[model samples]
Target: MKRIPIAAAALILVALGLGLLDLGLLDLGTPDRERFRGMVSPRLQSDKSSDTAPTIQAAGPTYVGRQTCLECHRENHRLHSHHGHATTFRSTKDPEVARRFAGKSYDAGEPFGTYTYHVDDQGLFVRIPDKFGDRPFRLEYALGHRSMTLISLLPDLQSDQDTPRSDRDTVALEHRVSWMASEGQLGKTPGQHDGPPQTAAELFGHRHEGRIMHRCVYCHVTTGEIVGQQIVGLTPNVNCEKCHGSASEHVRQARTMKTPPPFSVGRVDWDAESELQLCGDCHRMPRDITRKQLREYPDLLARFQPVGLLRSECFVQSGGSLKCTTCHNPHQSIDETTETEHEQNCIACHDETTPSTETSRKHTVCPVSPTTGCIACHMPALKLDGLGDGFHDHWIRVRDDK
Candidate 1:
């Protein structure tokens, strides 16, 4: 070929070199070449210390109190304040506790003995008859709002090894006596049975304070932090942070005028199963029960809606399309007010339209009776023996008679 111009020849050589480099057929490692490579590639300029040095990321957030949460969520706070969960645990000094126990005395015959309940300026006291005579035990806390049952919290009779009873070391034990509002009478605590008399010291001997603190108190109260033998900084009732994780980081971000990162306060991407598990942590689910336990305590299913709902065909068929929030609002009290609204929720999935049809492609109509209300027949109210009124069974199933 004819000799090309000097500029055109230089351009052709540069393009050929670049093409060979791109094809990994050339290795240019000279000092001048490496410096040129650094100029072209931005990643080459990245600090080498970044690759070897340890990351100094900030620590996870801590729990800021519920009052901090109430600053922004007043309506939710107001609605939640009226929920049964909000009043599950209360200091004995609360006026409501005093009103419930005012002038009330419970007397048991022979073996069990008699006890007189009285609330005075001194505090709530139960005078129990022992060998020495009637002795007074001061009640420190009250469990339940008396809508169903109310029980007292007594000072821990059994402390861990020689730990002195300091304010920091104090633990509350569930008392043996409980008031059942449905019957308008006091009875032996729900789990405890009526038995022969024992020494005054042995009366609350069955109390497992540590186990109760770990299993029961942790769920009943909002934030129960047990440091050693002491419960440090516990909120008496369930509050916002109980569901949403600690919001210290979130609050800090808001104060600093910065957008908080994802899941800065709590997990935001909870699937249906995880949401159920969050509620199940306290409510108890089928996975928490054994077959033998289920058989022995079938009536307890009323208290555990998650377990009952998991057993239902509706839940199994829907592939987790239904959740607790689908029919019940966690922000509100659980009562008859929500009962009428459940039919609408049921109809959303089980209406007249068939899955094969164009109108409703995803759900099937109720095979038994589409027109009838879903609750009464499918989820009939089952009375829990000691739990007062009937609790509608969350197990959605067909009733033979209906």
Candidate 2:
């Protein structure tokens, strides 16, 4: 028998390793935090602000004082309010703020028909039906954290009652306005992690969990410090350094009135990839590309969500490589620049058709000519809470056919 060449043998070995379950070589199992000394070069970034370390705070954890950066960055703080990260999770004071869904369920047949949720000074919780006829909804206080939102399953699909003890993630965020108003099904049980538990999420495969993990910090919190003792902060709040790097040099430059790389505000010309990489570092649709597709150190799993794997169906061998940030802007809203929130992600390439597809994929394509806008095609408006927001289905599809 002829022996395989060395390169071919090495390729086979790597492929076999990658395909294995929980390979120690790939992610080392945990995706949250990597041991710094193990991977990061020891060229210590000596520019840590303040020769003395931070003094711990009494509130809980010692915050790195977002005000410190705000001293030099008044404008940066102004822009934070518009982004999703700013008030993504706000704690409101007025009781009327909770009145939107006062008695919640008007009818039991209305999907989550029997659950009533209201918010008072205590925060958000729920009241469930004692019987099918129990007022169709019962009054209850919002438990856990008041501002905290959760997804729960309706009676029929509750995983805590149905699924085995061995699983989770087979769940939904309950008590949100989506549950009562949704014409579509909603809610989930906590222990039914058979594949993906939520019907909607399963249909879309899975969202990269890395977003729930550490990387969410770049977008969510205004500040983060990964000390040996603890990890802390909340999401949907963009802190200071999202635009500025590390804040050490920017802090130093503040003393001398020098400008930092990020806040420089100089006009520079570059391709979409060059520009988007700054924000795409955290925002890209992470798909795990295999060794065959990527040439660089694909081993860096925490930072790069394998966009290729997440939206593989969108790609055909015939089409060119579509990097996501090609259409989406990371730094500022394209709408702010052009007065359009949803950029034309679909039309920039193809005007796809649908009428001929199955019941699920069927679309009413015009007989004379077929045309669908990117907003309708991708970020179809999803009505959650009483508000209607254009939830761009992160599924990132070319058409309903995919």
Candidate 3:
């Protein structure tokens, strides 16, 4: 064996060392390798950064209300006002509430007996007459604006006290009778399908305190602060800060500088999972509801678009491209007349190009006309029995059975 050249021998040694390193049998500890490792595995750095991030201190920024936001974002405020979310929770003073209860009386015969819904200068009153005698409950809030059905919210009798206003709890009790806009009539409220009270005594004693303020008010209202059963501060509308988080810091920044710092609350810089969770908080994602609850309350699923969309094969395959904001502008009311626009969103992933017969790999084509609207078939409008409104299912799937 002839002795190899020094240069050749050096090259062989380097290659052998690299091979051993690749096989994890040797450690080079090179700066380049360390940099590559840092780039690929950033969780270690992220964990450290997150650990040191400033947490919410005691008595943070206070809610300034939607009017403060409207001063700067007039156009956005105007558009959001038309959204159903903005009008979901309202005081009895709202004109829509008056329209709903105007001369409307639901005569719930038998055990419940006759119940009259009346709106006057004193506000909404539900006069219930049974074997126990006539008792009128004051309705304080309305739970919906544009939906076919609107749930009435009465003042919580349990929470009613002669204590100081600051000490008193402002709570809402759900009324059994709900206004149905579609049929232009009053019927049993959603989830109360058991057909009123069983007996006359039960009707009189029924105190359906669903805890509307604590249980569901947070979603409907913006910056709702509940402290020990009492609602301290609440802006009864889905305002600018609701999705964007508390705008107190942003407002402070804006006041001092001509060009304020970028508002960090609910920033678009969030990761896909973070973005999903943000919307999922209110939209009722899969994590929010159990399989048993979903099966039992199938009608409730119609309202939970995020839950349905997350379950869709399209959403799974899209790998984070598809989101609520993909088709909807959160600041504005959803445009129902955007059939062509909606079809374009579907076409973004599902190209209309015909597959070649010779090609081994082929994409799934729309069984119906590819050029036409895809949503009509894939995400058909499903009528919710509870609300009596047709909600387009966000779950994008082939519905050949339909």
Candidate 4:
């Protein structure tokens, strides 16, 4: 592994902050939390912590945040009582969700007004909903994914779409047109519902609980995986361990105060991989090559893809150029999501006198307005009838919104 010179790395870090890496050619408003700003929060100190401790030799059991952690400390829930991610699986309170669904006046003809139970389709977990009228039913998870410790609405109509199961326990998954957007860019929020269903993977890929792996789980829920009977399932929720590092021990530590001897899981040693592991576990993206899915569950570590992350660039640049922590803070939220918030993450380091910045200082340029959000100009959303109906690309470039 080649190392980056401390000086050049510093320049690139500033360049990235100015949306100069891609030469000012790509729309920067995608709001992809993994990379740049726009989650509407402060930057999450992704910088390496100065603390150092002996590395733990053992690898613990695989943990899912809910079952593994919730059982132990019922008190922390008090602290999180105010957290939004802490809230998941409830009936819809936002009338906006109703409008987004019912008011979507598309000519698909489902009778928005004169209908009872107008929609009933699919959920992250298996579900069957009955339609009020002749239109095919669609199931809706009252809540999509929790971040900012709160609930976010699934914008892509197809994300919650599902079909019916017949006598043989077989459900014919249906694919349809939808306005999709990339995870990072926002160019006109491209109509993601405009692609051809030529391939089997593309057409029937999400008919059912279509193997929620790398690209799937993060969007729906934090810390998701296959549990229960492989074919019959998935337990989706804003699990606790997703952030605190497999709370099994953390929980045990809380009960008896013993996991890390004197310092329990709550005392995060920013120096250890513990902080990075839980986060890099997800923010790191998928690799071109990855682990095999066991019973539809993926080995997150084996599949990390750090999308726009260029290790070579980081290594060759100056030491303070940029650290993973520079743009992301695992403990924060965006657009109300706590897992990560890109749009606001940038503001932390891009402001007039970037206070939280570790590498260098930048002269403030853009006005502090919603439209001037880092992502508003760089990662602009592009809508297409693709995997993410209206996703922002994760490429982290500076270009036109086309």
Candidate 5:
């Protein structure tokens, strides 16, 4: 018998590993349920005022803050507080802050040093042993939902309650260790552990300055003006205005005039491609990634739903009908959405009764496990390394073999 080449053997091993990971045979570590339960639920109300509106609004529409939206949409506002997007970014000042960092320490080992966390009257702080700096770095922002919280040491700026800060390019650090909701302890942050630290900031966590820093805050916040390198007049977390676009005019017209003028709220049309672009802004889309990357390591891209979904046959042949909202409710937390509901969404498009064929019908039916296991069979959860849990592959297709 001929022996397989070294590279070929390596490839085979990798494929086997990926298959096992997809099946969740490997123990990446389960989230600490008690710790996850400790997360502070997002606040229902925002201190809405003209001054609190996003200084720099998106090009098309102006933001009016989620508070103004509550006047009209009370129910949606209530449900949105439970969503991961609503708690994506927050200051450490409040008791509702996601995780308490006090009395936590982890030894990263080797080139990376030990990281220690503590809370004081001022706020939470991290101490990283490094040649350049050994002082406790104040963690001003917590970025993530219940699954994980990344600690960010932001650039120092003078406080002026009345005026917005002038934007300027500055350095910031994302701590190497993140508060893992699963483990309930500090762990190596995803996407930060593999490569050698190129800069001092990277030693702790990925460095952010200028555009990078603004990008970090942009997705987490509902709306904010990017002034040079700073985000001013910011509203933290995803809210009604995040999806519905700026409703300042809509609110104004409704209040002042008996009949509100026909203000076209963004996402009303909600076309497949347009919705892909909107959701992809943060979830990541095909355009945001390269073709080579997607083709070479499709499993890694599973974390990004839009990227995978865009490549799926369903989105391609659905004739502009398919959208992220097709299966997902933007206002509700994903945890609330059940597997049964997702399977029903599959059944809605493809007839389970008939055999899949190249017929006049737009979609082919599943031959095996028709009504049930639609999501498991087609969009099997693929566990990406470092993400801790399996994310259902949005690239919907037949996967008979593991």
Candidate 6:
């Protein structure tokens, strides 16, 4: 881990204040949160605070939740609240979840069949009349923001109060259809096959056993214990502690000590490789995917940003200078950044004025249209298969036949 210079940190703070550093290059525009008002606020308490205290001791860090962060990091907290990470995971009971499905039914066509959504006093449910007859599966959780929300069917769960199912052998569904924000309607979930299903679970959605289910929720939520195939004490969404680590001790010292430690807990020093690994925990690193996937399905790499980014000449040659944080502000949504603002990062290294022969020069200057269009020419936005949206190719490179 490398520490950012104090001068550079100060300049970044100033740029942030002046709106110079505000940028989100991943996805444009914010998720529709109007329907989610008063519905999607993060659960303030960690599971360890109650019955899971013993598990916390075994697990290591004691998470204090994001609410404690607001006491000092007000601005960061405010920005992160609107981020996609904040709303990635939420209960199906969220008002928007119900409203989106109100009087809505999606005919998936053929063997997959039609799916209908409805809300009742009990909870939100999706009924597949063609497959399951009149029997409906209650939608337990949502796996994404408004952009595209994948509904979960937790048939094994005891109740909808938030805790994981008790049984170790329980299974869940990832739902065949997801609410595509672009279409404003339910559509086929990504990676689903066009061929007919071999089983009942295949007819509805992707079936996940214990380990798979735990992973699906683990990445979305901040902190949770994988107890007996169940992720208990779950904190919805990627709140502050997700990256900052457990902050209970930090908060305690802050309040009790007159002269608090400069920085006792959480990560401070970060290099390009370390930051890539940090973000790659969920976003998929090169190691996460097969070499065949990268070669055969290059377009799919658009979603696996860290994978493509690590392969990029920019990251490979930057000497650990270029990384995820170079263009993206982790706390803010990607929509906050414009293409021009993002191009600045390119300009920093690919300086047109810096001669190739100069000893200080380390990067090549773009001979063609250097001042602008860096993103459009180099890292173009690609529409992935099955996904109704586009993502900027993080493999920053020139586009000239090769």
Best by lDDT: 6
TM-score-superior candidate, 3 or 5? 5
lDDT of 1 at 167: 27
Q: How well is each residue in 1-402 modelled by candidate 1, as lDDT tens digits?
A: 122233331221111111112321111121132332222222222333456743331344567777786877788777787888788877666788777666776665545455676888877777655322445666666777664233333344334457663522434444556767777777656554344423343243123333443555666787766564445787877776666656676676667775544441233444576667667766766655555645664655666788788877778877676789888777787653565587888887776553444433466667767765778888887766666766777877776657
Over 168-219, each residue of candidate 3 has an lDDT whose tens digit, in order, gives 3333334557777666677766543244333322332222222323446666
Better of 1 and 4 by lDDT: 1
**Candidate number of the best TM-score:** 6
Order candidates by lDDT, high to low.
6, 5, 1, 3, 2, 4
**Model 4 off-target regions past 4 Å?**
1-105, 109-219, 222-235, 258-305, 311-325, 336-402
Using all chains and alpha carbons, the TM-scores for the candidates as numbered come to 0.74, 0.42, 0.71, 0.41, 0.73, 0.76
- Pairwise lDDT winner, candidates 2 and 4: 2
Superposed on all Cα atoms, the candidates' RMSDs to the truth, in angstroms, are 25.7, 16.8, 22.8, 17.2, 13.3, 15.5
Clashes of each: 0, 29, 0, 94, 4, 1
Could you give candidate 4's per-residue lDDT for residues 293-395 as a string of tens digits?
2223222212222433333233124343444555543333334343235655655555665554355545344543532456645544444332243244333
The model with the greater lDDT, 1 or 6, is: 6
Worst 10 residues of 5 by lDDT: 36-45
Off by over 4 Å in 2: 1-44, 47-76, 92-103, 106-113, 129-236, 242-249, 260-402
Question: Tens digit of lDDT per residue, candidate 2, span 21-105?
Answer: 1321122222321222111211122323335664331112123345675676566555544544444333323243245444454
Global lDDT for candidate 6? 0.64
Each prediction's whole-model lDDT (CA) = 0.58, 0.34, 0.56, 0.33, 0.61, 0.64
Deviation from native of the Cα of residue 52 in model 1, angstroms: 12
Error in Å for residue 375 of model 3: 1.8
Number of residue pairs clashing in candidate 4, backbone atoms closer than 3 angstroms, sequence gap of 3 or more or interchain? 94
Q: Which ranges in model 5 have alpha carbons more than 4 Å from their true place?
A: 1-62, 96-98, 129-134, 149-168, 193-202, 225-230, 256-270, 352-362, 400-402
